[model samples]
Target: MTKCRECGKILPQEQRIDICLDCSRKKIQKRFRDDPELKDVFKKTIEELRKPENVKKMAEDTYRIVNAINEMRDGR
Candidate 1:
């Protein structure tokens, strides 16, 4: 058995889906309706991380991006 990550609802193994089916469906619908660029960015990030030579660069870039995003969120 597994539990929903978001709601913490205990469910049987077959009944449990990643992040719970409801949360996953809502997330998918949200991705389709808004913030579609996030999907592309995630794919690009993964692709970059897969290359050995790009690992360090990707880590640094991710750090910078995360900091910038956090700063923006904090209204810095």
Candidate 2:
């Protein structure tokens, strides 16, 4: 058994998602409905992170995403 990261719900082994299922599903739907480009950016960033030669670029991409999210939050 494990606790969900987002909701802190205790779940059986099979039910344990990286985040709670509810949170994960909500995030998935949100990604599809709004800011779909972020989904692609996350995928590409993960792929880049997996490659040793692209690690620096991965960090740069992550920073860009973080800044973009922050800007959106700040209504900039």
Winning candidate number (lDDT): 2
Candidate 2 to truth, TM:
0.38
Pairs of residues clashing in candidate 2: none
- Candidate RMSDs in Å, in order, are 9.1, 7.7
Q: What lDDT would candidate 1 get against the real structure?
A: 0.54
lDDT for 46 in candidate 1 is: 56
- Residues 12-73, candidate 2: write the lDDT tens digits: 56542345546554554565467776677567656766788865444344445555665775
Give a tens-digit lDDT track for model 1, residues 1-76.
6776668877555552435545544544455355455566656665876699875455345444444444544773
Best by TM-score: 2
Q: Report lDDT (Cα) of residue 9, candidate 1.
A: 70
TM-score of each: 0.37, 0.38
Clash total of candidate 1: 0
